[model samples]
Target: MERELSRTLPHEPIRWLKEAGFGRVRLPREKGGDGASLPQLFELLAELAEADSNLPQALRAHFAFVEDRLNAPDGPERDRWFERFLDGELVGSGWTEIGGVKLGQVNTRVTPQADGWSLNGEKFYSTGSLFADWIDVYAERSDSGGPVIALVNVAQPGVERDDDWDGFGQRTTGSAPRVLLMRGSSRRTSMTLPSASATKLRSISMCCWRRWRGSAARCCETSARA
Candidate 1:
């Protein structure tokens, strides 16, 4: 898998984004994807992480948000975002906050506008937002009511970005904090499970199993005939 990814990734972001098939790993088959399930998706993530942790972390974030966008119940909006994501035109997700809160808690607020919406808040641990064209910024429930998942186009005038990521590990992830200065159209929604930690555990276990089986296979393949 590492060899495959190294051959495919090319050490270039734009090329890898289009070639890796990472952005849509869990997308339904009907939507121009392989339609991987949770376990199978984990397998792929493990393989990719074994090659490069940052690679898989970014991939996991991308796909998790992709799944969220696809399932968000906003049919036209979902299709719009998903198509852009698949085409590598728009990268997605804003997974963290500057205040160190856990995922799913939002300090951001989305206000409805005459056209779409306005977003205001700071996000931390945004793994892919540095190069992302859009972000799924979560916010507190609006005073008007309904859900609070807002898909904000970061290229807009009010979006602000700060790539302040200098972590010891996963340096290549490009994780950072971004502040949304304006609101946008939003809806109540659930987030798909992140595959980072799970992918790590699965990679370790699979490596052990492969080593054990490899030893056995070697024994069988190089045995002396009686």
Candidate 2:
């Protein structure tokens, strides 16, 4: 499938994947999804990667965001976000910056104002942002310098996306630099990960690694049987 589509540089496979209900594979059955287990999701991802490496890599943020939403406590926020996902909205990530800083540290600033808040930051390697309906940006709160994630509309004013990625390969992923500027007031919504502690984060990372390993093993077994 990827070989056939390789000739078209701007072709977005995600649209087809979403239409096939691949994006909602991890959501609960009650939430209009297949309720795929972690291993199942990773196995499907591995298969997709085997077909087109760039597709899986570009959609990594989207998969992670879906998992986050699924793990979120039952509330209006989770329900609303899940509904958006079911509606076929794609989300990209802008968590990493160009600087060689630590993983969790963010230089972007989000300041509260009289009317709302302001966001100012520059991000690099913003994978999938150009193709996404919404971009999740990670920044620091101006008052306390705490980490916060904000979901911003792709067409929001003062948001700039540059398709200047110079990589010799996977150029179709649209991994480029993005700038978000809020001169004075901008309506922004912010959220923090439930397990934001360093220890918890590390544990979660290990869990994900294990799940992927298990998925790979299962795939190998299935291939052997075939």
Residue-level lDDT of model 2, residues 1-226, one tens digit each, is 4442553333457788878878788888999989999778777888887766667667767777777777667999889888888888888878776667786677887787876667777787777776777777777889988777777766667777777665554656667654333344456444453356532543574578557757777977999999
Alpha-carbon shift of residue 182 in model 1 (angstroms): 5.0
lDDT of 1 by residue, 1-226 (tens): 4434333322375357566666666677887766887668666656655456566555544565555455566587667666775676545455355676665466666565566555667776666665566676555545654335556666676677775554454555546444334433433222223235543553454464456446645755687442
Question: Per-model C-alpha lDDT, please?
Answer: 0.56, 0.71
Off by over 4 Å in 1: 1-11, 69-75, 89-91, 100-105, 145-147, 167-169, 177-226
The TM-score of candidate 2 is 0.78
Quote the RMSD, in angstroms, for model 1.
Answer: 8.7
The TM-scores, one per candidate, come to 0.63, 0.78
